[model samples]
Each structure stands twice: as C-alpha cells, then as structure tokens.
Target: MTMILGFPLAPIRGVIKLGELLQEQVERELRDPAAVRRRLEEIEQARAAGRISAEEEAEAVNRVLRGMQT
Candidate 1:
C-alpha cells in the first residue's frame, strides 16, 4: 500500500487530484467573458433582491470585472 509519513497516500493523492481538477474548471469558467457577465448580473440581482449588501455587491462586481481583464 502507498504510504506517506505512515499515513495512506492513495486517499491524499485522490484529494489533491480532485482539487486540481476543480481549480482547472474554475479557471476555465472565469476566463470566459460570458461567465463573467453572468456573474455580474447575478451579483446585481442579489443586491436588488436584498440578498446582498451594497458593499458585497460592489466587491463581487469588482472581482468579476477584474477576472475578465486578466
């Protein structure tokens, strides 16, 4: 059995692999302009619906827009 520091390594490796895959998918979605726009809209809708505070909405908007720039 694979081991690392006396702990099984297989489960650890699987967790790491899953994290990497999740990061890749998130990055891919963030790179898309439409995804950014959709997020912005969602943020605004949340604000309008009183689900999010103005500051929260602004921060989310800024983050989404910033991601689009990169």
Candidate 2:
C-alpha cells in the first residue's frame, strides 16, 4: 500500500506510485527556490569537476532518480 498524492492510502506500486511521489516532491521542491538552486549548482559543479559528462550527467541524474522510483 502507498499513500498517494498525499491522499489517505492506496494499494499501488511501480510507475504509478513513483510518478505521483516524484511529481509531488518536485512541486514541493520547486516551491523552495533555494533548494532547487543548490541542486542545480551541485550538478553543475559535478560537471565541472569531471564527475560526469553531459550525457553521463543526464544518465546519472536518472539513475539516482530511478533509485527513488521503486
């Protein structure tokens, strides 16, 4: 079971559950300008430091994102 859209509860998993939570978190984080700014800065810093290339950065972001997916 999962609590979705901040709703009481629902028995769901995988894409639906993940998508809802991601969207919710994204919206909430979007409201926090500083946090979003910091995240972008961190990503840019990583790119500059050669931790990730543009392509790798995209993949790495999604990989970290996918960790939260399920």
Candidate 3:
C-alpha cells in the first residue's frame, strides 16, 4: 500500500537539497584565489572611477585580501 502522507514532503526535501547545493557552490567560489584577485581589481577600478570613496576602497581591499589569506 502506498502512503499519501509522505507525498507533500517531497517538494520540501527537494528545496532543502537545492539550498545545500547553492551553499556549496558559493563556498567554493569564495575560496578561489583568482576570484579574490578579481574582486580586488574591481575595487581598484571603482575607486579610480570615483564610484567608491578612498576609505571604501581601502576597506574593500582589506576584506578581499583577508579572504585570500583564508
């Protein structure tokens, strides 16, 4: 006999699995060295273009460099 009680939970389980996969992908990118360097370059360009203040650039550079260290 098939149980109907478990059917409703199937979509919930699939959503949870999808969320886990997304988290794993995000973590992998965060640890990538090239990704960190690219972010630093972007910050520099923004600063040069006056899109960000000098203080914001310094803060962003520090955050990106720290991410590289870890």
- Output the number of the lDDT-best candidate: 3
What C-alpha RMSD separates each model from the true structure?
Answer: 4.3, 10.0, 2.5
Q: Write the per-residue lDDT of candidate 1 for residues 1-70, one digit (tens) a residue.
A: 3345647666887999999999989888988878887888899899999999999998998888787666
**Candidate 1 at 36: error in angstroms?**
0.7
Higher-lDDT candidate of 1 and 2: 1
Q: Where does candidate 2 stray beyond 4 Å?
A: 1-27, 58-70
Better of 1 and 3 by lDDT: 3
Candidates' C-alpha lDDT: 0.85, 0.68, 0.87
CA shift of 35, model 1, Å? 0.7
lDDT of 3: 0.87
In what order do the candidates fall by lDDT, top score first? Answer: 3, 1, 2
Tens-place lDDT per residue, model 2, 1-70, is: 2445645434454668899999988767655657655766787789999987999778765644554444
What is candidate 3's lDDT per residue for 1-70, written digit by digit as tens? 2458888888999999999999888878887978987898999999999999999999999987776566
